[model samples]
Target: MIRAKTILALLSLAAPAVAGDIPLAPPIDCTLGETCFIQNYVDRDPGPGAADFACGGLTYDGHKGTDFALPTEADMARGVSVLSVAPGTVKATRDGMPDIAMDRPGAPALDGRDCGNGVVVSHGEGWETQYCHLREGSVAVRKGMRVAKGTVLGQVGLSGRTEFPHVHLSVRRDGRVVDPFDPASGPATCGRAAAAPLWQNPLPYAPGGLVGAGFSTTVPGFDAVKAGLASPATLPAGAPALVLWAHAFGGRAGDAVAFEIDGPGGARIFEHRATLDRAQVRFFRAAGRRPPAGGWPDGAYRGTAQLMRGDEVLGQRTVTLRIGG
Candidate 1:
């Protein structure tokens, strides 16, 4: 028998004019190399503080939207488009803001314009959605344009108050915030689920996971990552160091972190292990070395990172890069 949620999704696609119920798909394709993660959810806490649908520390105080973060600044540079979750007419749009990550020391302050290059769509009957932190020139739709589910609205960016590259999506009804994960509109108590879910298939939120992983010939800063102002990927033979780094979120004390690097010959060139002494929202680690008196061999190189709790692995990522012409 077909599930009711599946039928609802089909109905939303077939009848875009329908009001009151709009099914949502992922705003960005995570299957692509753009392995994005949810940094925050609409604050469910009522008392002027913060809380996520899962009641985790993944969210910050007063965060009123769902944040989908790209792995690195380089990924933002390559461009990843954000999609509309449902059909609607564009109500408003803001563009031309520079894609500047706030992590830089001298980054300009946006102040009141924190949404930064955004698009809003009204789904009728007071229902609306907002997509923010879009690339300067990536807005594809203008005000009053009819857009369907999965329509490309803009590219994910680091344009607003965000220190990382991401797109923040906000859903509202009559100007009041709504938690799509909790349709019944109650606190998301641990192990106690809401009676109703707004989403046909709610996006899963993983608290602790690898946020970014990549390789470089030179050590990169939190911003100089591929998505930032990092060095070229093509490494000359005998370069100083062929570094592999990984950044993560939701790390806790006692967790084991591991790193590995393999060269063109498929040989493990370097490996290291470490333990976390405290929790962190953003964690970074790397492994590399200068070439022997000779230099690096010409070919592709691979890097892998893992986070383990006891013997079980909590998160992991692998990335590859080409060396030489």
Candidate 2:
């Protein structure tokens, strides 16, 4: 969230350290670019503007942690474990915050608890890692407990001042915030050579990507797509219309989303490309048409969606739906 820097400053305590770097493992148990995605990175810009470590617009001003985000609320409900990045002792933790998006009605006030349902681990040499927005009652470790790398701390959740479900990870060395992707904390030079990343296995940077795609009987609402309920495995032949939709993140103006649907026997049913007019942190688009006069033919239908920036495809997905199967 935009306020992460403030939260980290309030939570982190100074300590001494040696010179070696603390290599980190991914803190979440999921496939990157599939089950989960990097929604934001530590804000590298020191002024009022914001930029990710790659000098991209994936982060907001004052954001101090990396956000590993789930595509839908249903994914969060199924439980995704948050793991320890390295050997450490639990320094502190908080649990019991309800899993609710901050923008929802009746959501609880943060009340200085911006790092909801979280854990702070102390890796000696003044290195500490903090995991935030864990699900209610999912915290598995306690203060003073020794833990090895990959230890399960909790499940990701929308429990803090966040609009989506994700675990916010903040790394601090000797009480100063460190960008795990780039630990040398000065103004980020976009193309400058740098030291090795902190992750044990370096993560590739993605500027923007698709989150979800599917076929529906009608244009689906953004909320339904976000809840993982917009797409069904099958639609009756008599369904009023066939719609292909996609959800995406980090879209910039001038980008385009293309949608295509192919019926049985490879017959093209519809195709359309919608262009983004402005930058959006998250967005959804749909395209479709009413059924033919004969209702429909029973077989498999394939829907493909792609996010494009000129000739380069940022992300693409193909989904199949069966009719009268």
Candidate 3:
């Protein structure tokens, strides 16, 4: 989180105001709910507890920014550009931070660089934006460089105090943190559409969503799935087991993850549902079966996964696998 005192200091060199609200553009190149998803929103709760703009549990205590997260580290390696939300001059920047999860061994102590490898742009009129957790050596703009809306600043990475690959965007006005989704900063506005959002195109709020799904010969580790190495394009007909897995985020207790597999001729081969016992930032569930006496049939197979909250489907994905065809 960017501190108010620091923001006040950074704004001292800001350019003159252009007047009116600061219209923001989508700060990332990927599509929401697909290439990327909103992992966390600004913490709207004033107490020690946390709440998102929607009065949901998609935020952490004192979280000051919106986290747009990629599904896997593979997506980060492919390079997703982080763009500027509005026209401004680059007031400050930091680069060269290693891209590593904060919880991983050998991670560096933050000291005060919580906004690791970041860029701060002065939009004037007491308004400014901060982009954090950019990839090392990826910062493209220099101090005092003018930028327009959609200008590329850097790529999202696992730098700074982050456990995942994401770009944290913080908006501020007059040195106070502002939720772009709800600038009114009132609890009454929770779950209601913002009368005027900062983004040029307002984004929809998803309580939870599927990140990715795929087929594996056996149950895979969560780390492998997150690293994009769990799913294979094809499996042998005699494989030990045929497993289908789904990765998802923003899960709450009582939410359910359902998995189904259809073999050649659309025959139902496997089906299972797992209920979450507690809220999780991200979770994965898998179901599978061992081959029968004749070994698995050689043909195409389809797998479908859904994240359900009661009868409501929060998200769903389908994957296909070819077996010795």
Best by lDDT: 2
Per-model TM-score versus the true fold? 0.77, 0.92, 0.92
- Assess candidate 3 and give its lDDT: 0.86
Among all windows of 10 consecutive residues in model 3, the one with the lowest summed lDDT is 6-15
Candidates 1 and 2 compared: the better one by lDDT is 2
Model 1 TM: 0.77
Tell me how many clashing residue pairs each candidate has. Answer: 5, 0, 0
Sorted by lDDT (best first), the order is: 2, 3, 1
The Cα error of candidate 3 at residue 163, in Å, is 0.6
Clashing pairs in 2: none
Alpha-carbon shift of residue 81 in model 2 (angstroms): 0.4
CA lDDT of 248 in candidate 1?
78
Q: Where in model 2 is the C-alpha error above 4 Å?
A: 1-19
**Model 2 CA lDDT for position 152:** 99
lDDT of 3 by residue, 1-325 (tens): 2222311222112222334777787789998877999999999888888998767788999999899999999999999999999999999999988998998998888999988899999999889999999999999999999999999999999889998999999999998998877676655245465446666665767888889998888789999888986467788878999988999999999999999999989999999999999999988989889998988888888999988888778888899888886
Which clashing pairs does model 3 show? none
What's the CA error at residue 89 for candidate 1, in Å?
A: 2.0
